[model samples]
Target chain A: MKRILIINPNSSEEMTRDIQDFATLYAENEAEVVTAKIEDAPKFIETYQDEAQAAPGMTRLIQKNQKHYDGFLVACHSDPNLDLMKEISHKPVVGIGESSMHSACLLGDRFTVISATTGSIPNKEALARKYNLGKQLTSVRPLDSVTGAVDKLDLCERVSRDAIDEDGAEVIVLGCADLVGTSFELQGRIGLPVVDGIASGLSTLLGFINQALFISKVRRYGGHV
Target chain B: MKRILIINPNSSEEMTRDIQDFATLYAENEAEVVTAKIEDAPKFIETYQDEAQAAPGMTRLIQKNQKHYDGFLVACHSDPNLDLMKEISHKPVVGIGESSMHSACLLGDRFTVISATTGSIPNKEALARKYNLGKQLTSVRPLDSVTGAVDKLDLCERVSRDAIDEDGAEVIVLGCADLVGTSFELQGRIGLPVVDGIASGLSTLLGFINQALFISKVRRYGGHV
Candidate 1:
């Protein structure tokens, strides 16, 4: 079985557990997926300062564990240490933000990102620029919810739907890792593909590993070598 | 100086000259830009059979020439042999379709792609899926121009503006390499960021190389034999 190391660059073990459970459900017999949170990483990264603080801790974790795993996934919507980690590791590494945003494009004709904060919107835009997905993005909307950093799960479902109906978002990406399992009910309500970044990252990880295995077999037959 | 090897995977010497002239204009003073066309490669690949015939020729060229360049750019809008070439080349390789469409997202809130043939809409979609930019795309429309696959420079300005106005395209991307040098003027008329894929690819190459250089610098600071 292929092994995937998912690093949540925050101190919230509860959020880490939530993502781990979801990965366990979907990873199937195809792979053995392991999820861990950095003990020294910050809790609730709400600012660029928080993200900056969290990067070195996450990079340290990736450096230590990268060789043992087939791939590494950074489990933050902001894609906290994407460039730094991709540089250090030879294995395919994907951030939850990059993977989910990519998946949202496949599932919908257009997409609107429902991020945690207004400050995070610029962070997302920078990501869009880095990955070159800014044009595919309709808008990066901030839902006016302040208290739910990691505890509460409440937001305007209607506003998100309007983004789909009026603003032309065929897919809704829940831009928080803590938003792992909550989006399915929203998908049921909105009647459009609402994506959880954690699940999408896991699915993409599995796809990448399976693709690598398939290519390895083909290379054994005098291909791509 | 950063070195870019821009390869026109066709036998058209005229197109090669056009691309070389275009690349020279935008490339930085610290960059060395050069171009070559496959003398034995197919001319004007307009259909799948033509593309299929051309892929091997292009692959042969990549195998022969990829070693000397820091970056490789396939100077065709169709982006023939894109994935296969990336798998083969150790250096950062980009195709105009891959680079421009990916770059389009960086320039605006939403964008639409205008290709040369009706069949290419699906081709564009496939590229979107491959690169994970499907969500940011407004639409991929084709201009059923019977002649001059993408060099209809005069018509591009008018059609591209219409696409931006009618389709809510905040950014306009010149989808074909033949439209490369002309997008800046069209952007002036359209009043949005216009992306020529060649420029986009060149920029992306620099971005990737810069990241690689940073990583290499970090590596060099540590103990090395």
Candidate 2:
């Protein structure tokens, strides 16, 4: 099995558990995933203030565990510390936010991110710009304050239609780990691909693992030695 | 000087001369550029049928002259045989469509593509998908046939603003070789980055050349033969 590490940039054990469960449930047989939470990170990241506070904590986590993992996944939706972590780590690192955007782009001509708050829009925009995904973004819609705080099942139908009928979002990116398995309901309503970022990241990590294995095989065969 | 070849994939000698003049006028002092037109191809590419007719001719041009060029620019905005050419050529090859979309994504938080005809909208959307650029695209707008062909200057201004103001396109991509140098007026009008695909392709090619040089130097000096 290819050993991979998934780092949740926040200290929330609940969020860490969400990502861990999803990775464990979906990762291919050839893959093994481990999850870690940054002990010093903020509880919730609904704004840039939270993002800035979370970045250094993530940096420290990767710094401590860089050598043990074959590949890394930054599990936060904002992809905090992505560039800095990539510069320091020898292995391939895939950020959940970037992988979701790439996966969504692959599935459709355009997609819009539907997130929890308006405050996080700029952060989403920043992530889009950093990963060269600014062109495929259709619209960024925030769940109204009432909708964001209420039970997700109550709001699922409304969110799906708004993403498709109003914004013309051909692919729907569930930008939060909290909505992990809501794809069936939402996609049924929207009649388009509803991408779960956490799942997409795990799948992308598998591809990277295969790439690393191919490189190792080439080296063993004396092709590059 | 770095030698670059810009190939106009269609039989339009008029368009070929226009692209050659633009490259000669703007390319850096360290870069030398030459332009060639495929003598047998379509007149105007407003639909997928035109692209299908033109692609084989472009493949022939690249096959015959791939060895001498250090880098290549596909001057046609439709980018008829770009990927096939990349598969066969040793040098870095950039399609104006892909290069401009990539550059526009880097320059701004969002972009919109404006094309000359409604039939070409799907073609632009397909280009975005092929390059994995659909995520950054704000919208694809089409200029009505009468306005596009008869009112040339007015057509450019209207298309630029429609992308920026109405569609939330922070970077405007001029979608055709016929739109060359129109980015200047568009940038002035839109008050944001307006990318001329031809120029963007040239800039990206220069970057590829520099990277190749650096890799060559590293292989020679940092390793044993």
Q: Give the best candidate by DockQ.
A: 1
lDDT of each: 0.67, 0.68
DockQ of 2: 0.02
Q: Which parts of model 2 have CA positions greater than 4 angstroms off? A: A1-225, B145-151, B213-225
Against the true structure, whose lDDT is highest? 2
Question: DockQ for each of the predicted structures, in order?
Answer: 0.03, 0.02
Model 1 residue pairs with clashes: A105-B135, A135-B105, A136-B136, A136-B137, A137-B136
Query: In candidate 2, what are the lDDT values of residues B1-225, reduced to their tens digit?
Result: 888999887788788888888888767564799998877678677666776777787777777777777888888777876656665555667778876775554334467887867888888898887676777787887767435345655786777666656776666777888777666666565565567878877765664464231111111112232
Model 2 accuracy (lDDT, Cα): 0.68
Question: In candidate 2, how many Å is residue A219 off?
Answer: 49
Cα lDDT tens digits, model 1, B16-87, are 888889888777553689887776667655566667777777777667876677878888877777656665
What overall lDDT, based on C-alpha atoms, would model 1 receive against the true structure? 0.67
